[model samples]
Target: MTGRNDEGAGMAGGKSPTADTDVLVVGAGPAGLATALQAHAHGATVRVVDRREHRVRPSRAMMLHARALEGLRPLGVTEELLNRADTTPEARIHLGRRTVEARLGHADLPDTAFPHLTLVRQADVEDVLWQALHARGVPVDWGVEFRGLFHGLTAESGGVPALSEGPVHADLQDVHGGRGVHRSRFLAGCDGQSSTVRGLLGAQWRGGPYGVEAVMADLELDGSLDSGLLHVAVGQAGLVFLFALGEGATWRMLATRPAVPSPDARFGQLGPPVPAEEVARLVRESGLGAAVREVRWSAQIPLQHRIASTFGNDPIFLAGDAAHAHSPAGGQGMNNGILDALNLGWKLGFASTAGRPLPELLETYGQERRLAARRVLALTHVIFFGEASPHPAARLARNVLPLLAPALPMLLRQRWLTSKGIRLLAQPFVHYRNSVISRDGTPPAKAWPRPGARLPDASVSVDGKLVRLHELTSVPGIHLLLERDAEPVASAALRTLLPAEGQGPLLHVHRLTSHPGQGVVAVRPDGYVGFRCGETDPVQLRAWLRLVGAAPG
Candidate 1:
């Protein structure tokens, strides 16, 4: 651990160097690179290493939820991502010829900057993150693979283990030629599910496979159609999804039967080839047969859900698929991983620069994210197999709900389903209640979701620009304070609590006069509001700052 250095001296852009960075981030996927970028911004020297010689494979995680957009906003790439991708605001779930077009954009829900999920290729998202990281002075070492980890305990004057300082070693295998050893104060594993870091740490990944397989293909369509809707057809043939990819392309697909083996076994079968004729038939059923003339990419993937037993072990930690693997039913895989990176990035940066033991802050990573992953698994089950009810009464309600869709107001309300579905699909809304990192307090008991809850999306103005509440709080490694009027004194006091230099565990203070009941609240980098204080409790504010290891006045 070391103090923050403001000097922007390190490898950035395309400059390659053989130097030791403060942090070694393995895996340049959404999770790894994001961790690297945020850590670098916080003023820590970062070196990102990835096993792949080239960019990540252009497969998986095509659906970018609204919350993910919120996370990207601070990274300064939300608009770029939207430009590179298409969107589907509504989705139709066809159950045995009984088509139910669920309006995902519900009217009652508060509007967001990114109201609907954006559909973009995985490669594009990674490309943007890579470029952003490079521009900020952290570059990834592509084609370098993480082999194993070396751990040695630091001893005090006596023969006792010194928790604060230790030498951690990493064995790396370069794709081009030689083998090398890298040392760092901390390490992050953004590698996929079969993580070498997790293996070396001997962390347990618990959860079984859903036993479903799927064939996926990315293609360009020929005719005109609303590229704003995702179509899920569940007929006698099986379940298939037609996602709109930008540039008049559609992702035509199918959901296979659940596998009988463990989660790992199921993931092994992803990306098998499918016949072009069958793909054409699926397109025809979705009314896109004439529009689709070419298949750009195709593969098969298994649907499995699981979370690592622990998110980290001392200096080494996990994020993205490395920490948790889940069913792609709701397109939640990448979203979960990115959120993990967002949560861990600032904490790691803060701990490293402050000279604190990594374990003190690292323990919270799993406590918060594992809960989210589990909840996501539950929601996926509800959407995929949660029975509305086989009872005659319940059956009638299910059938009648769709028939009433034509009404003027009802049609508009149906849009809420998409928002709700997206809420369920993306687990950002889960609050950290029981976790050690979260404060112990109850919100109003009658609140529908309860207190210590994720504050829902609301309309607000940022620097005179109207923006979604979620968008106002996306910068990573920052503690955001939303208030009604200028509190320069409070802002200065908060700044004094931060480290002298380094990217910031960023501390953002805003005044929201428009929303009256909303008082002084502190949101963590992962977008979780950690502390909510009324204008009255100055003492509690100081206590929270100290609890989070921030500087004291």
Candidate 2:
């Protein structure tokens, strides 16, 4: 079910008749759209499919963190996101009698372009990404459902003449029951928590539902609640979160109160509707002074914390909610999934188009991201437990929250503490230093841009124009950034050591006069430093490139 023996069959030479596309992405949500876009950006032909006949209008996830924005920047969608986003810098936390403001902006952190926790409906993001895909001439095959998976060319229904080892043949059915086969070098499952692909791969989905139950509704509210700030109300009753949606509904509310057990109440799925009066009552009780004029949509969400045993299953891989699902405590679900797509996108592009076996390169996608998901799960678990648990300790913490309100402003005033804390929540702190693809040719102390860490943004002159370091690495392929004084090699000379023409992503080299003497940093397509060295040694650089399949072995 894993490993490829005929890597060259579908790459380099004229398109192999065995496969219809390089990457076939299932599910057209945020993750799937991002995966397809990233793969396409990296030179892979992609196909996207979603089971729904039309796009969903409801916005499930509502926050886009800094790291996800950084990851999506290279795809040319970040500007639009910023334009449409609510770049609110703070959230007001209400605790019974006291209200405190928590900072959500990057005034304290100066390394990234995205400066705040962007508040935008998930539907707007999907629309932007789908539009990007549309501009690329890659349309989503809506109403097409992924039914089953088969390896190689022997799959029934339009089977290829020759049997191959690498490509995946997936069975798909349209809304009308028309059946067909989609053959691709790689298949990505961006399906939701109830993932058919994860089930088909037999990956163990570990974990269970959270004891807390919550209801989410988008309502037209007539109230004095500040429309510019995210609102959080914490009490022994439970947690109530409100956001100014600014669209179909005036505000969005997510309240975690013990569900009233009605015989007709449905638990997990979209709802046995939460009553209008009950919705208004929850808001009123939270002391937000908001009256729900109209409930646009309401649903009871059964929260769960779970992750798959493996992210990649050979030619088949899972991303987004399919790979992991956790409490929306920090609003990490959609952001984590977007970052997951960025991690796996370029890897799939390389594996499908390298024209040579790249087992190590392919394997790192799962190794790096699976561990990242585990860490996110741990973080969200703690936050969710603190916010929703009925334990004495949790109750004490909630009761004491108001007492600490006086200190909140003082704490937020500390630039270092606030920056570090916001960076942690914003996800710029996530790194893959231990990944196999990350290599350091120098001692840790000497590694200025540490391998496996995100390539930090720095202003430097590129051909007499000042540009951020990330702008240089934003393009598809490997970027070798060198200080003018550290490495004497010409950009043309460095290009000679990369993979044979057309074998892999192009290796772009830049010599910046203003770049610090950090030796050489080869940034990966996903904006992480894959290789870093104090001095540019051809042997070391070549070895690192070859290790990551960026150079011919």
Candidate 3:
């Protein structure tokens, strides 16, 4: 039973929002917002919807990692994130009287613009993103709930006559029980762990929950905690972690101590109210002895890890928490999820608008991101079990860890004297070496990354102003990067391949004489090398471009 309200057609009466859009994005959380922003930045018409009527104030993820910031910088939202977030450079591990501190400072890692972890409430991050979206004329439609999915043009709605083939329809309900239907070329589900879209699509998750149960709460406290570093205390009772919320005497405390698991008013959902005694006892046992003046919010999370078998079901694709769920141990969930949107955003943006055959483009999103999530799940699993496990071996290790804490910093400084140490903690190195779009067959005359590897953000001069290499590729389409010496033949060949009227916005031609390599590189909008020719082989480069949907396919 559904009410079909006439006003629910769209924000305007001319055309349904979904019908006008190339894609419909579900979920208004961080990942959904990022997806919408990235898609729009890449020149695609997008509409976003979320079930929730209001933005939640409670923090889900408190730390934004370096790699996420790097990936997001192209969208021009990084500056605001930096302005609002608190920077932390270290994580200290304390065992009774001994301590070992590791510095995650950005100063030591020169490869990225955002070198350190930024501690801000997840709400703040969302606020900044929401503001950016609104400022750019892309408004998030709140209170609209996604109810059901339809294939092609349904007879009941019969909306948007132009949409004839390969269109997906979504049934949406308003807050007042009003119903409407919208159509799109694709649907992106950035929903959470309890994803309605994933459930409707019948995609199964392949992992299980962690064994440990913990209590996390944001509280105003007074202790010897360093606001500039993450404080971890390991004892026989259990493990305790303190992360600064970038506010005065307020921190998010994650602890698993010798206590009973909390029983919430609702089962399987976080943000349940906990007994005062449980919160106090847990903190007292952490050895921090910080008094909880006020508890803004509390949650009892039985950490779970889940990854969908595939990221999508044809026209229905999953991103963000809907695609995968993991422990908050490494602070990788939101960051990794946002990165996933960046990976798929440009692909979807171009594919939806290309109006031509992009045979291998759309499917690569699942192939590349699904594999990355598997690796992330493995890494975060180890981190949670090692740092927060309640095992007998873990208890024993906690005791011995203090003895080794004294020499840990010196070992880091002396042994990790190279870039390897810093790079280890960064996001996992992701490259789609075996994906069909990856073509590493062409050997370069000069040094260059393979087709599947990241296109390094080399320093280059644009319009006589020095800028990072990513700035050039951030524009909408394929970028042909070549050294000045290699440009004569390379540019001529590309010009001939392009139509006589001149190139469409789908391809950007750049010849940087400042670059040191004599090779030619075809960088995709998502910043991966689609093709590379080390030598002067314009013919092979043209074929590679055609294969990547850059040329007429």
Candidate 4:
């Protein structure tokens, strides 16, 4: 808001302290912190604000898919998360009397450092991001409630309705009793579903209640529910899922039943609140044999699946849950939101430094993410309905599902089929094929996946020493990995295109000798390969840069 809360590297990283910052990120959750950190890394001065003074309590997000982990790598937070999270490779779904289990491991994919679903509370993830942001000279200003835009509107979403707006002029109130108005070149609504930014912008959030309600609680379990195992049981009483929460004999318990009251109804459509007695009863009825010694926290959440019609408008943008909401079936909500921030941060970083809001670049954020969210929402819906529907076929599958878990290996030929199943649960397969920024070119035979996919991490030798591909490429700019001709060296054209040390264009060039005869791969800051072509072909390189809006205009 005012300089009283601003003491970081001015937004756009080096900009001097001013009421007009480059990027004012709202909410300090994974999405918000990620947006702030990535923007800071790109040298944009950033201000991160959160209405709450603390991290999310009773953490909701519990799984970090491979793609999400990869997205976090550049932020310097993924490795720490890897060290702390539990790697869950398989889940046993006990439907009726059947136990559907399969080996769900990520190790089969060599590109992923942590192939398994990293299980850590969302709070821990935020802590890691927050610590990194703090180190970068940006700290989260907690307990600041966003009121509204300062210029054109007169309404406070949080309190007294007083607002105005032009561009992204924002107003904030320090819960400790101070109010100030400020403007950022760009503002991100990384806040939760009830996003102030989204509401003020009047963006349409389409979709309705997911027709399901799930009661959940985290508690010390009976240890019989082994760590790293997620078990789901569906019966006439509805669906119950159980999974361990790190150590301390604690586990998260959930039960989803048929639709309750609608948010518009007198009862208000939400997860009908569940008491400890109800949780215990649901657990016992599902035959999940875990003694709940103590309950830490519990709530009834009406599962929701909604996506914003548009991601953002000009100086204002939406990300994370604020942009899209997902059904909890695949645990894709938080991860999808994180990826959204990842996609937008670099673009904003580049545009902010260019001294003007790049309209096309800003517009691409909504185009890419809104479409991606549709796919995720659709996928999660099928899975949710398949397990919870009352139809006969759906019922038959749920009943016979667990029985196949044991026979999957033999029936589907363990290695290949199980690996495919595991791949479905991970995010490595997602690509921005339709993105205006993602281009394609003739690729080498050695490339495992096609262009537009996040470049797979590899180990290559440079200067006679082995170096990880990520180590050199994980900087704040575009990275060019030109395959060497059996030696560690870059072609003349490749070297010519490289920027002088610490200068404009934010380009990093490296010659990788491990994959001889391969072409040059240009990777975006988000780590997705823009395109690949002959190592000496500067034309293709220039084209890729322009496509991603990274080339010199």
Note the Cα lDDT for every prediction shown.
0.63, 0.77, 0.71, 0.70
What are the RMSDs of all candidates, in order? Answer: 6.7, 6.2, 4.8, 5.1
Which is better, 1 or 3, measured by lDDT? 3
TM-score of each: 0.79, 0.89, 0.87, 0.85
Predicted structure 4: lDDT: 0.70
Worst 10 residues of 1 by lDDT: 1-10
lDDT of 2 by residue, 30-116 (tens): 999999999887767898888876765577788898888888988889999988887755788897888888876645666787756
Once model 1 is optimally superposed onto the true structure by TM-score, how far is the C-alpha of residue 72 displaced, in angstroms? 2.4
Worst 10-residue lDDT window, candidate 4: 8-17
lDDT of 1 by residue, 1-553 (tens): 1101221222333233357777898888888877886676665778888777666565566778876777667777788888887653577654443445566544234545666666777778888888888687675776677767544522112211222366456666665455566777778988887787777667788886554555677777676544567766543333567766532345545444334454335362345566777566666754333455787666666655677888875677888888887666667778878878877777777676765554545687778777887787677655555222233553455455445445534454565654665655556556776655555323321211222456566777766778766666766555555555534466656656666653354566676656554346766665666666545144666666555555442
Give the number of the best model, judged by lDDT. 2
For 1-553, candidate 3 gives per-residue lDDT tens digits of 1113331233433233434477788888889989888887766678888877666556667778766776777677888898877764577877777677666554355556665657767888888888878777665777788876654444323222333356777887756566667776778899788777887767887786666666878777766677777888877756788887623336888786433444432212465567767877777777765677777777776667889877874467899889888877777888878888888887777666566756577788999999988888888788777777778887788778778777777875652452354454456477777788877535653366777777776687644677777778655567887765664777766654442242246566777767666677777766677777766586788777766555555
Sort by TM-score, top down from the best: 2, 3, 4, 1
* Pick by TM-score: 2 or 3, better one: 2
Instruction: For candidate 4, write residues 1-553 as lDDT tens digits.
Output: 3223333221332232244567899888889989988877775778887777444455667778877887778777877897777775577766555556655554477776666656777778888888898787675777677778655555445321222133466777665556666677788889888888888777888987766676778777664666667787767545787877732336777677666665453111233346777777778778666666776667777667788877876677899988887777778877888888898888878776654446776787888788888888888888877866666777777666665566654754456566565567665446776666665655442453455677777788876789777777766788877676622343454454433345454777777767676577778888787666654456666766655555555
- State candidate 4's TM-score: 0.85
Model 3 misplacement above 4 A: 1-19, 152-164, 246-249, 257-269, 412-422, 441-446, 460-467, 474-476, 492-506, 514-517, 535-538
* Candidate structures ordered by lDDT, highest first: 2, 3, 4, 1
